[model samples]
Target: MIRMMTAAALAATFPLAAAAQVAPTATVAEGTLLDVVAEGRVNRVPDIAVIRAGVVSQGATAAEALSANARQMASVLTALKGAGIADRDIQTATISLSPQYRYAENQPPVITGYQASNSVSVKFRDIARSGTILDTLVKQGANQIDGPSLTIDAVDSAMDEARVDAVKRARERAALYARALGMRVDRILMVSEGSDGGAPGPVPQMMVRAEAKDSTQIAPGEQQVSANVRVRFLLK
Candidate 1:
């Protein structure tokens, strides 16, 4: 005769087997990792203008050349001050006195005279008045000039905005990838920032019309600040 086993008896006889069957099996599956890079940019009007103003003078001797350069540079400094430029904003960039050499076909090079140069980097907080200041510098003996590099004086806010945009774009891209691969985005595992294009650099110099009848005009177009980011996401 066969005897039917009750539930309690089955549990007692095969305790481990019964526990395995009823144990929770809803564990989250391992997700596929993905990495994506994205870039974001912000455009804004520049607030400041940087320009290099310099004087070059030549004389028969080094002392004379330096003296002439000093006189001219003094006038340039005075002009800058008259235009309301702060003393801290004017920084000496270059000061040099080199011997002028005359190259000969057969004989050795001869020192004909000396050339001296003095330059300062000037930062103009007022973009609208920078051109007028530049013209005044020219009239005051600043012959060698370069750059009116337009840039935002305070870029921290703009950079932050760009960074946020970069993260947003990265997330969107990651979601798109997850959808394409028939999966859903689980979470972001890691995030890292890359290059920041908002940092200022040496901008190429443009032509300055100092001799024009009207005052010099400076047009600061929109400047772009960019940020790059790399994100790692888990998709399941």
Candidate 2:
């Protein structure tokens, strides 16, 4: 959710200027100033999936481990491309080679073997194929799978809606306050927008891996986007 926030300092910052509206000699204009803060939130169905997949291989030597990991990772990348994943949508996330050690009670740790891992982050624009693609990746030797985080690729429209709602709420609150004080809103003095969640609210379902035989159910749950705004109204 996006919300608008303001502190008493805001009004204090321009105390002299605001007081000038009433009279040069007036000490305060409490009845003539109205401020309100409000927040708006909107929900939308996610249309994109972010999948992090990788391959881990172990061997007796560092080179052997790296070589095996490379072979598996290559197959995974090839499978992703064959499934229509573009190069730009795929990014190398991590690559590492670590030595395995055996712990002994009466002796120092001994080097046992070497393990190599490589991971990539893949963005699936087409939600329908997200599950199928993931399944294919696993079959193609992706042993280290992390997430299928869901999100909406384009959030401009949803963000606009939230902003509109926030503005509406702020105006309503200002009007209510003015009416309670036996005054009417003359005009909007200032309006400030607040920060938003940017991306979707939550990672709805963080998928680790798909079940065997059954198709992966990539459920892109409804995402909530919020906006907040603060408004200062000139009352008469």
Candidate 3:
């Protein structure tokens, strides 16, 4: 569902300084000014899912840990490719080799083992197949996984819709104010965009197990795309 809200204030005079700050091209006309702030929102189901998948390996030496991690990560990448993920959708996110330490009562910390990790960010255009592919990645040696951030792949259309709604709301609000003040709206002096963005719904991180019998399920509920606009109307 789409929602719209508007707040308006009537002013006898508009300061030229404030008008210049808000919109450089705005020209202050000779009339009572009505400023309206309107917000429009559209709710939509997410079409894309982004997840981070990786492998972690530990060994006595850094070389051994890195080698093991590399081999495991290779399998994970192969699994993703086999699942119809394009190379452009997969990006290497992190890679590191760190020393694991062991502390004693009165001695300096000693190096116990080395841990190596490699992770990649994967964008799944098909939301329905993401859960199953995640399960397959885990079975193919991915031990570390994060996210599944649901988002709208194509947001331009939604944003344009919201913008139109905001403008319409602003015009109605200005008309209402003009009527109440025993005046008529002559013309719109200026319009400027305020805070505008899409808010994605929160999704919990999945705790996947290789031995689990149940299949992983991903649910992308709904996200809201919003647009805010400030409009100035001349009342005569």
Candidate that scores best on TM-score: 3
Clashes of each: 0, 8, 0
- Model 1 clashing residue pairs (backbone): none
lDDT of 2 by residue, 110-229 (tens): 999999999999999998898788888888888787777788777888888988898898888877777787878777666667667644545645444534687777778788888777
lDDT ranking from best candidate downward? 3, 1, 2
Q: Where does candidate 3 have its weakest 10-residue lDDT segment?
A: 1-10
Candidate 3 positional error at 210, Å: 2.0
- In model 1, what is the error at residue 94, expressed in angstroms? 1.0
lDDT on C-alpha atoms for all candidate structures: 0.77, 0.76, 0.84
lDDT tens readout by residue for model 3, 77-134: 9999999999999999999999999999999999999999999999999999998999
Error of 3 at 107 (Å): 1.5
Q: Point to the candidate with the largest lDDT.
A: 3
Candidate 3, superposed: residue stretches over 4 Å from native: 1-30
lDDT (10s digit) by residue, model 1, range 74-139: 999999998899999999999999999999899999999999999999999998998888888888
Residue 209, candidate 2: how far off, in angstroms?
A: 6.1
